[model samples]
Target: MDESNNNIKEPEKRAFLKGAGLSIAALLVGGLSIERYAVPKDRSVPVMDNFPLAILEDPSGQPVTTSEVIEFAGAKTTTTSSPILVFNYPLQDEPTFLIALKGVKITTPNTPPSSGFAPVPSGTDAPMDGIIYDSTTNTSILAVSGICQHLGCVPPFLDYHPGQSVPFESELIGYKLNGAGVKKWPDYGLIYCKCHGSQYNPVWGGRNLYNNGPAASPAKHSLPQIMLATDSNGYIYAYGINSSNAVIRTHLNFPGGETYGSGVKSEDLTGGTAIRQSTRSLPANLSLYKNTTLESVAPSSLGTNQSSGAIILYKTTVVSNENKNGLNWKGTF
Candidate 1:
């Protein structure tokens, strides 16, 4: 009886082993087939075409010239009331700052010497590479990406702070006028980010001035500059983007991939509808820490036409106090 039981057990074990072997072989074959089909046949890098030259237009469909920007921004010392101009270039959803640094004359490829600060490496274009100059008045006009390099904050949270005019948020974050005591900040107007305290020097190609402060610059790269040009008629046009290696926030193709060289990725440029025109208007009072009141509403005609490929540039009036109507105060002083 023991011998008969052993014989039956051996045959059953053999049958089970045969079945397991077949299952494992089938799985391996299936996995190989899937892998073969899943591999992309074309692994070539995408061809990125150069962006088309887009004319900067105001809300009224008029071309925005360098002279107009200089006049609106005024002189650096007296530009306390001038509003930050906003526009879209290359793509409609990509908001850009159109700034004239008051009395500052920005020269091309304005990369500062690497004395104590890390300058942009040689062979790469600096933020000033995109500056447009008015030959008649020698006024310097520049456009930089409005999106914060840290966390993609838009205007108001990532706006410019002119000299002598300190925002409540700026003072709270330790950015003084001219960086008086701050070792990290520059001694001039900065494109400051209130979100995480990233400060960019407008005079030095939107270079990030990060070191030691209550709120230091969290961004590792400078703001991407938009290449500007003027026709014989003095109309400013955005032709391309400089600082191609510095990726624009929210404009990345892959999850964590490098941007296409030559200042822009053609695939990204064509992803969104191009904004044909933008108007000079006040920024929205969206500060959670402060109460804002609309002093004077911009023209409703231009504001309502935002869906028609036009952007309303909201003027930012950051004040020292909070709970005030129309005053944009983001933090305590």
Candidate 2:
């Protein structure tokens, strides 16, 4: 076998942080006793009535222009509670141009974007970032956070041949199991974690085996995904996401904990028939809203079929709340 043919892609470098004794529970938005369920608002356009809506004005208090996009990573850095940012206005310092972002992915970009952008290390707490290059549209500037949602570990990106076979050891690029039962060699994605033997997918969104890893179901849920999008001007925006969801939350508990009811934090009970107690760190139980009912009997009996006789049903198909254990509440919405 040729040595060149044996070259394997390395796993993306990941960061890790100690989270013991910390209240990892999610902050219930707007503060309410029981979680309230509501249909999501349209995110296609600006529907939020909150402050800091418009991009912060530039010094000398002038708006940004197109030429400015070429400078300082495009328009003014936007901050919002909605998680997604945009750059639709023109820069005051440069040529006039428009920039807009839809959801997390950049559906549009202006001019030819950069070919390849490097990751800028902002700070210890600053989320890891990356850039995307799109040739089809002639735009390539993009950025995203690189922290892993599973236990606050960072993911290391491995560069490998796109369409070639590689060695398992050379390809070993992530945390793997070692010692009695702990993480060791947090390098070389081996689909094994030294800390807990938690297997991870090598190709983005890969599968995880071993205990302490996300369960197998809708395999897509195995990997944490970063939200990304670009504006009409070519600047990219990326966001981080938690991996736990309704389906996966169950796997989050210690084998002896309570099985019924949904939530994140669990109490460790060593007794027989032990029940797992949960803390506020988990998502609320599955909630259902009445969306369907028996059609009007009058229509059938009276032989007068009308649109009112039909019933509709609305259920939560799937939700990954991100905060706490997102996997705690999977099922029919």
Candidate 3:
């Protein structure tokens, strides 16, 4: 019985040795496979995105300036679109406007929002980059390119907010208060990009203050401004290139044809309306708090007869104000 047990143990040991030799052979042959299954240390992935203010090579081989002659129906004058239009006034030697023909539209390149840059749109073209100046009013003029700053999608002038539109909210991150000092849902303005719910401020430079979009976001940027131009003869032209580049002489033609509108005169803008109100706001009140008693502290009774409160309201009968961006207030308390 002992001899038989020994014989069984010898066979078991031989089987174990065979299995171990096969395992070692497999390990040497499959070493690369083990490494292939190893976990990766860097998990970061890159994404492709568009940028606003992307410096395109000024439209490859395209003329920096162009000229075109078009006749508007019922108008006796013929307007010539030209780069020379930028220097309409002797004092203003640069173009400050871009005019689109009646139905024609212009697009800008893709740009990041935080960078205040937006992707320029495709399919729209202007003989000259949109930049213009108005000699008649002594004021500069510019128009928005139809493209959205959030994505390359062009925004429409919808009567109401689009379903997917991005509403402009505060950048303060937390809940915001309203003008009434009541804590309210954050809502500032309507600058919705429906494709991805990115909201912007339309009145100010197109600023992306809210985000509800893809991982790729806009940088700290604003919409690239398209400049417009007006010649001495009142011809309006638009181009994307800056006015400082060496002049390229070509007749800038509007492929979609030209549109025309008589600019509103300064007097016409005011409609000769009578000055019924003032445009002056009072200075802020600066009164220190007073300690009335051991148990009572009162707000300074000092107040502005003109305006007072958390926000100072002001009204004035103004004869004139030289400051262009100054606040013009009117009210009676």
Give one digit per residue, the lDDT tens place, for model 1 in 160-183.
776656667678876555544453
Model 3 over residues 1-333: C-alpha lDDT tens digits? 011211111110111122223323434564222111211121121110100111111112111221221111112122211111111100011111122121112222233234322222233332223322222322222333322333222222111131122234222332233345322332222333333333443222212233432223241233333333332333332222222221111101212211112110000101111111112222222211112111111112222111123222211111111111121211110
lDDT of each: 0.46, 0.20, 0.22
Any idea how many clashes model 1 has? Answer: 9
Report the number of clashing residue pairs per model: 9, 67, 56
Clashing pairs in 1: 281-313, 281-314, 281-315, 282-314, 282-315, 283-314, 283-315, 293-325, 293-326
By TM-score, the better pick of 1 and 2 is: 1
- What does candidate 2 score on TM? 0.23
Error of 3 at 110 (Å): 23
Query: Against the hidden reference, what TM-scores do the models get?
Result: 0.58, 0.23, 0.24
**Considering every candidate listed, which one attains the maximal lDDT?**
1
